[model samples]
Target: MAYNVLSVIPARKGSKGIPRKNLRQLGEDPLVAHAIKKSKKSNWIDHVALTTDSQEIAQIGRQYGVDTIIDRPTRLATDEIPLAPVIEHAFEEVDHEFHYVLCFQPTAPLVSVDSIDEGIEAGIDSNADSVVFVRDSTHIYWRDGENGYEPVASDRKNRQQMDEIYQEIGIFLSENHIVRQGRRVGDSSEFYEVGMYEGIDIDTYADWILAESQLQRKQVLYRLIGNGNAGTGHVYRGITIADRLFEHDVLFAVEATEDLAIEKLEESNYDYQIFENEPSFLDYVRSTQPDVVANDILDTSAEYIKSLKEYTSRVVNFEDLGAGTDHADAVINALYEHSNPPENHYFGFKYFCLRNEFRYADPRTAIPSVERIMISFGGTDENNLTAKTLRALSDLDHELHLDVVLGLGYTDQGSLDSVTATYPPNISVEINQNVQSMAEHMEQADLLITSNGRTLYEAGSLNVPVISIAQNHREQKHPYAHISRGVLFLGQAEYVTEENVRTAVEEYVTEREKRETMREALEGHDITNGVERIKQIMFNQNNAD
Candidate 1:
């Protein structure tokens, strides 16, 4: 427990999504600022440091008092560079002994300070090789091509029969878990279930849009995506999709911004460009013009894209920029589209759904349990619902676990803190950001009291009985869509009242048979193997020619 924890934030100059992503602003601060700030604030973290080759990113780290900047070499910054080696190289540079090495990406701007503390505590208390923070995604899977996505018996077996499945939410806590460490899967690593947003990363422009839009909840750029805030969502979503797609080289076109989201991208060290004007954007494309340019149009002007499309063979308008039906050859939707289609058409959620390869827990083993009420309203929740929901949950008569998700871009952490301090004995508050599989956590819960958005879809997919809360004007419009389809929507006709929220939970909780029915409906959702499906689409398209 008394060991030094070295926090390394890897950032490189070369990027494709938005130029200088690491140094880029996510709301008012840079992307790396979130992780660096969170690391600095964490009670368990001894020292917050950074690993980067970019002087700008290093300077920003310095601005935040993050002095440990490990200069990553060009060799390790390559597109083919595996993260393990990059992390190993940095740890090798450290001369002192450390208890835990927490590696976080600036992209995951919404990482919760409490979750970091929890992971560190778990790592020490469990006496495990590594206590990595992860969110369990039960509905997610990948096909081996044989099972065809049929639910694995291990997944469908009784709750007692299932094994917990965890993914390395880019944010990792390494406790000397390598080959030399001695133990399978990196020194008997244990998984910590953080909130859903923490699992987000930027892999493709579409994924980037999904992460940002989901958190902002307002149409900033496109109806699907939103203002550039946290870089983690963009980074995680992009990586997930790129990992799925086989042959396409994902390029990110980011405009210059003063937000932390951009810095996170720079830290990612992907092939990217920073555009200041239309001419520069066009020049960027013509210079290293990739086969396809996945535009992360956070603030990118239309003229730039219009011109680039003329010169480039294919410009896939990732739905990052407000509806681009008029601009590109193809549009990538992480939630709606699954497979590649003919020209003039695009893909969405279907493409990004969970793959079968990730199904670690059998459904049979999954117990019919509901304990916590998950409240996730992206970073910078334009609507301050975190405190409101906590107040409502505190009023509930039955024991309820309050799972609260905080975003780096969230401006109301102070308010959230105030709520946590006043919470009743039955209410438990968890401040989290980037987590692994969010679906698995949803699966464990009985009633989900959240806004009608991405998390709702995730809950629906997992058969987690949901009580949708309309936190904002946009949410108010269709609070009951999920409920009409069998998921409960709570805020229609008025902002979700505390009494109404409690009533909805009671209604869902008391009826065991109704909960079972909801679970069955969740079973019908097409299994999402976002990774494998993307792999098939990209590989097939890449090999088609």
Candidate 2:
């Protein structure tokens, strides 16, 4: 059977702490609207009514589709009047009878609808006379006496050893018959404990400011540690994920020597800070205390991960395959794979993080002949693979256009400039730096010669056939750069000769059937929705805690 429940929201114009507090805007809506909306959304609430002496408050309640409005008299609306008489007046004003009454205050706008419904269900299930919402309080007790100050309880005991104390948070539910007998709570009453953020009451100006700030977007910190040795894959990956998080206040944190990473952060116009060591970084983390810390520092140590856990609530690691994986809350390694990965670890091509531009671009169609070839080796090509690939392409007899994409950290610009100037009439060299339209370059090219990093996934998304060269030992073990996936993996850059690169380019240029087969294989993998999948994991981890 369904129980008839009535929810009442009382708003008065005589608030001494803050004038017109109920009608003032908190976030997007007034303070009183939150209470009315929560009551209307409750499944156990049969009807909702507003009791107020001010016409302005009554009009606002009508806009929220309240069932009825009880116009309180001047005598009963005074400061000395108790809540029991006001609830009794509202009960007599309504036309229909109710079995239970819920007294919700407009000041406590953080109370959830589920809590209200749960309180009603608890009162009906146990056949109790009253139900109240409470929150745990941890404070030292003290009292004033005729002599001086005295301790109310034992002051020697610690907080954990002390008994748990709960304080009522302005919400009261009682049987209608008991409320009519001039009692807010009867002898039999139960309590429902709520979280800290949910039981906040907006009585003072400071309290209102605190509630409004929480309703805004959450703060997120991206701790990206990328350099010449570690490569710039983590830097680019961190920026891509931060751009997609539009609902958060994203900031970048890097080391003092990571000039390339700092340049990219400034180019993207993001807020950032530079630290000297791990201890300084931990100090910054403790000072800010963000809701989540996105660590893109490659492999992390167990001690470093544990130190981060002390400052932040959640730690999300990207491309991590070290002892820290055992302690991290969530780990995402898209390039490498493990035989027995952890439960929170996400590996393989399914979680590849691509930029927004490449994910939304249309797939390119294969042409009959190879005309243009593109070369890109991440943001900081520490191995100087661009010069090596350009020299090999210059030795080719086939007349083709070369688009050499230089990174911001490329230091050997004079050597590349000399090679471009000494090119033959049949061969042309076009150097592009910090290009935003990388997908456009990939789409216009017949093939791409790059490293086994984020560019490999971007090229695959456009269905551009690639010839991947490992810049270091780490990229050699990357599973995504394989012949089955339309990529011709040419071992490492240090071992690959000029003749080997030229021979491989000639084979793909002459055989049209081989190029089409590679393009077809590249289209088989779905990498467009990897960002969404990773976001769901982070959000699930946040809600679980």
Candidate 3:
């Protein structure tokens, strides 16, 4: 059996906070037009009605093809009046026998028609008196008392450990007969839950600003890979970009074997999924219909980029040296620059997206004596560069401190301990593994021995000179770590022996003028604001399209 549902949008002309708010422009349509158009688009709503005391709102409704324009009295439009009487008046004036009445507010432009239809279905299938929308509230409560304000509960807990509290949002549904009794909620009620950002209601200027931002938001997908061999730079880069795009919808997709990537995202607030192959990932992308797809998997095939372009308007890639770079809308390679490159390529250290810690890092003045040196390869240093560098630096025969930073995915954490046992008592070794404080160690170190990957740029952001080595032939192709960027690049992993690393460290330590020159070179280039640069490139092109 089909049930007849009437959706009512009650928009008063005058608002206490924002004048003429209902008739104000939101995107291409006025605020009141959103509810009317949504009601007409719904699968369950049978009729759409608009009730307002202002003729401006009525005219706006007529333009959106509302079924009826009911005149609401001025008395019922005041701030103190309850919504039930206005809904009742609308139900009576529509003249059609509607089995249900839906109350949708103009302030809630982010609520989708699908949520509305589900609320109606939930109300009718259960034969409930009313249905309301709610979201989880994490706020702690304190009540006023004779002495002062006191905790509502005797027990205190962190927000993450607090009991769940649900607060009502902007949509309501009720049976027509129940609404006619001048009541919105009766003995029976059902709750429909909405997401935190989706339940945004516009009342004050701050809320209006948030609603406008949400309205312009887009959905993005980050496809990348991470492992013991390839390192976790891609996953960390994706997290950096996603954090900047908080207003937009961002998701991370990795393979089932990417346990390192999974562990990293698990510690974050963002959500992710595991895919079996390209076809399954594309199917998920097709279903979600994201506005853009960002490929950070190092190198991509032409067919894969084409497949992504089939669903989204823009496809952006990172550090791509493959043929798929031609098909992408944009390619950002912060470590390498291309000669005779395509018009879409953005290369150089100016596009480096620093981690959150390095963005606000303290300015460094150098220790002058080069007492501390940081040795970090990456998350999973397959080459055991930290051990090699530590062993080589132990031959310095001076009082030196070595800070070895290991990521969550380092497979050779134990091998470093074996190497440190062989170190001289004057050369102390401390390994900081699976820790989030990498920037603090880097700040204290006078120099760093890192791979020719993303870590070198992080060193440059803090003006830390580096002795760079390539873990593989592909990383050897990274061009930004040469003498111009405060880094001295050694050959690939198989060729860079202990003698080469020890000699390079001795030069930076004994020669203060060389370290000062490297610091001046790092200061000549800007590399911290690359997140905002990439964000503008992704969002501005989508908006133009």
User: Which runs of model 3 end up more than 4 angstroms from their true locations?
Assistant: 1-3, 78-81, 136-138, 142-170, 379-394, 406-426, 483-485, 541-545
Query: Which candidate do you rate higher for lDDT, 1 or 3?
Result: 3
What lDDT tens digits, residue by residue, belong to model 1 across residues 1-545?
Answer: 35578787777777777667777776567878888998899897776667787888888988988747788888988768767777777777766567678888777776678888888788788877776666665553455657466555434555445676665667777776451243213647888888776666665566556555544431111111223353244544554454444333455555566354455556656455556755676676677655555554433455656876666665554433354445665554443332455455444434443422234433322325556767776656666666666666666656668776665567667777876787678667777765555655555566666665556556655656566666555456442344334477655425566677666667666676777776676566554554465443332354211
User: Each candidate's root-mean-square deviation in Å?
Assistant: 23.4, 16.9, 3.3
lDDT of 3 by residue, 368-416 (tens): 7888888888767778888888778866877888888886668776777
Write down the lDDT that model 1 would get. 0.60
TM-score of each: 0.49, 0.63, 0.89
* Model 1: CA > 4 A from native: 1-232, 245-248, 258-260, 266-269, 277-279, 298-304, 320-323, 334-343, 346-348, 353-367, 433-443, 470-486, 491-494, 530-545
Considering TM-score, where higher is better, how would the candidates rank from best to worst? Answer: 3, 2, 1
Predicted model with the maximum TM-score: 3
lDDT string for model 2 (1-545, tens) is 45488888889888889999989998888999999999999999988889999999999999999999999888788889989888888888888888999998888888889888888898889898999888788667888978798877756588898888887788889899878998779789999888776788888999898778767656778889666556566777778887887666788899898877887788888889998977898899889898788888888999999988998887889888789989988998888766687788887777778887787677877668988999888656877888888887886777889988876667687888877776777777888987877877888889999988777888888889899899888888887886345898888889988777888898999999999988999889777777777776665534221
Task: Kindly give the stretch of ten consecutive residues in candidate 2 with the minimal lDDT sum.
Answer: 536-545
Candidate 1 TM-score to native: 0.49
After superposition, the stretches of candidate 2 with alpha carbons farther than 4 Å from their true spots are 1-217, 226-232, 541-545
**Which ten-residue region of model 1 has the weakest summed lDDT?**
217-226
TM-score of 3: 0.89
